[model samples]
Target: MNGLPMVVSEPGLPAKVTIHEVGPRDGLQNESGIVAAADKAEFVRRLADAGLTTIEVTSFVPPAWVPQLADAEEVFAAVRDDPAVSPALNLPVLVPNMRGLDRALGLGAQQVAVFASATETFAQRNLNRSLDAALEMFEPVVRHASEDGAWTRGYLSMCFGDPWEGPVDPAKVVDVGVRLLETGCWQLSLGDTIGVATPGQVGALIGAFERAGVGVDKLAVHFHDTYGQALANTLAALRLGVTTVDASAGGLGGCPYAKSATGNLATEDLVWMLTGLGIDTGVDLGRLVATSTWMADRLGRPSPSRTVRALAGASAGEKQ
Candidate 1:
């Protein structure tokens, strides 16, 4: 993708966008190899220096479940002492339950996250529980976090489609999302975990949330790049005034349920598109690309971000 058109034709678009960098948690969790804690801390510092307002530093999930994030406490401690990092910024950690939430609080995390699925099959497969069971488990955790004065964000995955079960019901998504909001979650991020959502699907989901009396101010989006529809879906969300977006550096994670699903929309690609559309993300594209390259090097693979490839190509030509 070449990114958003530079022509100033579109008259009405949001003035700013919030890129919630999830590389340390979501991105690294899905990697096949383990990333050192010190390297992860450096990555967080670099992303912060590059001006990413919300960087998901790590997850508080059990080490047996996600071995990659076993060093969550270490990573959290490392970033907490960095005086130059964003003062009021959030370093959200994915907390699966009260135990994970407790671990997050023990690490002095100001924000934590919980995730569920719209489909029962996905919920069971991913979280090893029925849909209702998952909600029940998250209820107390959300309530505890709320009472403690920490921000909690809930993620509803497979909002558009599921691998085991085809198209998911938008009403189900809205139901779970509303429940999450009711549980005192500060934000509910609807995730296209399989990247199967189109712009119309995005509009339908947003419409359902609207009709259910859920405020768009607390709505965010997390779209995968499986079918290359993430950017389009993001545009649709932006049109509906959704500002917060979850993205991974280097497009590092794919849905575990979908074999063909690629990864979360690249942070560089998202920032590039948003910048071209006159949406300020407060992220330095050059620095973001460099950070992606660093992680890609560690993984011994090239990044999948089109913007990164194009920028690298252009820089090479200039040097030549």
Candidate 2:
């Protein structure tokens, strides 16, 4: 389906937006039931078939830490050799540190991501290091990934508000973001890990980054849907000319570290809004909803995405 016309009243929005699909990795990582490597491979394949060019396939963190992605290498191998997979598809794996980066590189991963937190409590609890120390750990990882001819992405978690720390200062978020960029990260994804951000907070964060001399092009927004405001926050980002967005299929994942944090914004839901806004994403909404429905069945639950649920219900009614 084509995007709607841009003659409407939207302002400062990009003509096209890049939806970075993170279901296979971020979405599944929080699941209690472990999905087999082959199923994970099929999941990635299906997402690509649905025209998601950028999918985060897996993470190379230690198996003990995240057993859900224990078979990262196996999962990577399955997709990397698939003839049906697009050669130009970007399958970025999360590399927590040097060890994870080495594992990803060993598997011949072309892209990797490193994550840091804007809040000290989360940094200490999640990474087991102070914020500065965590960034220090990622610096070498990002540098080595770049040197290895692989693109690197940095994830700055708790950008808007942290569960432990009530409200986060946008300037501090920008400071952490700039450090990641200076460390050779090609792109930085600002994450609202606890999902407490409103549209005003989103705009303030983006504005701070822009004022700090960081281009919006180097930034992506990753919002959790816990507060039911992911779509609103995303629209705020889009209105400010930030094009890249990180989302999961079926709204599958949440921050395991943050007890209150919920699923990432669903890709299907995001696409529905973007298409209606006349923003080109090149994703087939029907196919995306179908893919999410299939995944929801695998997980033995209804999808968390409003668009997916509505579309599936309509399809069921039509069949009836």
Candidate 3:
């Protein structure tokens, strides 16, 4: 079977797009078992090797909160060991609070992200605080990062739908998003936490942000394939001129806090679609497929990414 991705340029979508790879941190954090620091480092290295420049390596949340990333220090050190890693790589770590930010910055992390929830229910459940309280929590973190002159990103989860809240109000989501941007976030990634969003919902949310004066340039989309709407929603985001997309390599992870949140949109799948659209992601598809295949082997399971399975064949070891 042919593995080369066919190109077909579409109108509106940019000629080039930036992919934020979340497999290492967001992906692995949801695994039922803990992945060793060495393997996690290898995973980050392989992704960088595959030409994913923007990679979220690990989170600085307390180990008590996320045992999966208990070795955050070791993992960060191992990945940064390569002299060639930084100037060419964009490694961002998630910081849950002031302590998390302090730990990451202490290790010389140049880029950090703050995660928030659009809904009060999810905010309380995932963050153990109210929606307003969560933002109050991030204020200091973002401020400290700015003072330190490190790049900062803000992740707004449940932008589309929330498990406990049912369908979320697009306007409410807009308010939350604008608030996050006002908090000094360099970029805001809108998430479809439970994967219940369709392309229309995605477009409406983006339009809401646009109306609120949050241009597409400062926006990113993070989708999950739970309802198989990830690709469709991503296409909508691209058509609307939103360039940055968050995807997981080999469809590796979901929300550890949101139990219903399934795996993220796979990096391989996003790359294949972008390549077919004639959009430059600067990623080598074959190498990316191989990297996912290798990661799946180490994780002791088959990848859920169709592109990986199709390109790598039985080496993918995918289950139905």
- The lDDT for every candidate, in the order shown, is 0.86, 0.91, 0.92
**lDDT, candidate 2, 14-81, per-residue tens:** 89999999999999999999998988999999999988999999999888888999999999999999
lDDT of 1: 0.86
**CA displacement after TM-score superposition, residue 18 of candidate 1 (Å):** 0.9
The order by descending lDDT is: 3, 2, 1
List TM-score per model, in order: 0.95, 0.97, 0.97
Per-residue alpha-carbon lDDT of model 3 for 180-260, expressed as tens digits?
Answer: 888899999999988999999999999999999989999999999999999999999999999999999999899988999
Candidate 1 accuracy as TM-score: 0.95
lDDT string, candidate 1, 182-208, tens digits: 878889999998889999999999999
Q: Count the backbone clashes (under 3 Å) in each candidate.
A: 0, 0, 0
* 1 against 3, candidate with superior TM-score: 3
Which run of 10 residues does model 2 get worst, by summed lDDT? 1-10
For candidate 2, the lDDT comes to 0.91
